[model samples]
Target chain A: MRWINVLPGVLVTFALLLPAPAAAKTELYSALGEEAGISRLMETFLLEIAADERIVEHFIDTDIERLHRLLTEQICELVGGPCVYSGEDMVTVHTGMGISHAEFNALVENLMTAMDAEGIPVGAQNQLLALLAEMHPEVVKL
Target chain B: MHTNKFVGVALAGLALAVVQPVYADQGRFIATGAATTIDGAGGGGIVPWATLSSYAEEGQWGATASLTEVNVDDFALSVSAASLTFDNRFEFSIARQRFDLSTIGGELEQDIIGVKTRLYGDLIYGDLPQISAGIQYKKNRRFDLPSAVGAVDDSGLDYYVSAAKAWLDGPFHRTWLANVTLRATRANQTGLLGFGGDQNDDYKLMTEAAVGMFINRHWAVGMEYKQKPNNLSFADEQHWRDYFVAYFPTKSVALVAAYADLGSIAGLDAQEGIYVSLQATF
Candidate 1:
């Protein structure tokens, strides 16, 4: 292709990679409702997990209350809230569970549904999902 | 109409639809199964990306049927295609294309068979981009126009490698996906005008790409570009481009509309128009 025709394509690609405007920098911790919001969200998320047939089996024998608490803490820490994750590392916790990628995606889907039910904005939801998705390799098939 | 195999597959697809409950475990997330390309491969409207056709994740089977129409200034193209994916790892697709030469009269037709395999990575997970390799065998059933235009072969093969990636937290806090492809081919106007030519018979390397942003989960706006080889000596072949909007109302259906500029084809200049496609995933 000629340089002129190629220019627009290059420009559009650069536009795709462009950084978000300064106004997009909403604090995730605050957007997710801090301690009270995180706690409520975790409760809703656990409820979703319980209802989801795809991933419900994994938690059948586990303590629901404790799992909820650790999840809240993990999200709080990951989103820069005033807390640290109290649970074991992702790899260690998921090791030998034989979790498939499909099951992992189901968990994520349920989480998204929970976030939607909590009325979280799309931006904030994506921010939280990004943080969690980083743990995919560590959690799946570990 | 080169269609016996397509009839069987279409029937199978209908039966699968009737038994949708049995395959309800198609586990991939919404919008992960990319749209079928014009050439019948899984990807964007025109540029095939690294992504597969349907939402079949691990231990699942998924299939899709699609119809695409592109109306340009002096020509019109209609494509009917179907694809099947397994375990999100491999994709097999078939397509038939009919090009109406409105300005010059008559029609040209071709059939294509494609296979794509996901080689590495994930489109939305981890750091690395999803990578894949694909091959397409194109057979032009109508070769009279091609012969007059100096094309040497009625069939050809295209080999391509593609990589695609998405960022959930992209610019403006909206999700975005980008794909780049490298292809080797000797096809003239994607084999509709036949393969090889008086000017060039050797496969020429080409680059294709697509970039899009999801305004929300169901609505996405994007652009695609495909570089072409000018093989025929009768008329100059130009690159193709389109800007499109794709909607995923649900995992089972997608609608895409675009404005495409085909530049020139078979001596017709400034050929540009609307492109529309509908896809049903089963």
Candidate 2:
């Protein structure tokens, strides 16, 4: 009752200012094509990362096949897919890895480019990036 | 004409421009709460939000400098400001404004010093809105006419609390940001006409809001509305609103343009015009 007078103002402003809300028809996982689609996305992402000179040296000792499999599983689970992530947590896997801020940003840039090339929607791509952003503390050693 | 204050701000900004920033934690997303408001706060064109001025993450220092010009139908106002944010938590700012009443053939000037601190929540990472509290201390330099026209004082302080929330890719694959603020103030015409008046002297609670959407990583479009307190009886004061577009070509530089409606100032009705600002941060 106390908010009745102001409610109309708020509603009208929100309606006029915001874009129309998107329908909730698809989960984030489904938007990225579930497991099979994730695999292809990971393939493109990994290939681009390999070619990136800024972060390539850090991956010299990494196991590419294992890394790819774990990435696919991790992403699949993170995005509401059914896959289970059996890989080590970000901190355990990345501690002492000497990851710098520039390297991390470069990695994200490569990931974004790969997503664009793979036809991933901008929303899905940003969602994925948001989830990954939480892992920065664990991944960045410096 | 207070040309020295303008030159001082410009020189300080130039000095800051030459210092190379050393980033600590590359925290926060790109283009997150990156625009600077006309009042030297982090936000949209007209209203201040709860976000920090720039992309500086926790434990990092960020500084921003901006110059803004607003040309209304009967007047022209220019603001020069600079702000320093520390650890994405505390913000300190100083701004000088020169208002030229072209129609009246006179000018009014004011200096504002402000401090803001984040109290709780995060703008992007959590369910709760980011909240901040701030105080702006304003002093009018040219107030002889304002005092004669029923203004009670030439100096006043404004206190405000703001909340900002960001939803990433929540709708239409675009990031949306919404902010609300409650300010307690006695300033008339946002302090250009000084504080308090013959009709009313008590501080009034005012509401302001800003809603925006990120067009992409480097561009944003938004609208803002700020309520004002009508303290002076000589001329009825009105709320302010603007539709704005902000572009960030690089992480350090941002440009904003808007169409602002300042309602009534002094006695001029429908003071509508163009607003443009340039800001650089590191």
Highest lDDT scorer = 1
Give lDDT tens digits, candidate 1, residues B74-151.
888889999999989999999999999987999999999999999999988976789999999999988999988999
lDDT, candidates in the order shown: 0.86, 0.79
- By DockQ, the best candidate is 1
Candidate 1 achieves a global lDDT of 0.86
Distance (Å) between predicted and true CA of A84, model 2? 4.3
Off by over 4 Å in 2: A1-64, A80-84, A89-110, A113-119, A130-142, B1-26
The C-alpha stretches of model 1 lying farther than 4 A from their native spots are A1-4, A11-26, B1-23
User: Candidate 2's C-alpha lDDT?
Assistant: 0.79
TM-score of the B chain in each candidate versus the native B chain: 0.92, 0.90
Pairs clashing within candidate 1: none
- For model 1, what is the alpha-carbon lDDT of residue B42? 92
Worst 10 residues of 1 chain B by lDDT: B1-10
Q: How many collisions per candidate?
A: 0, 0
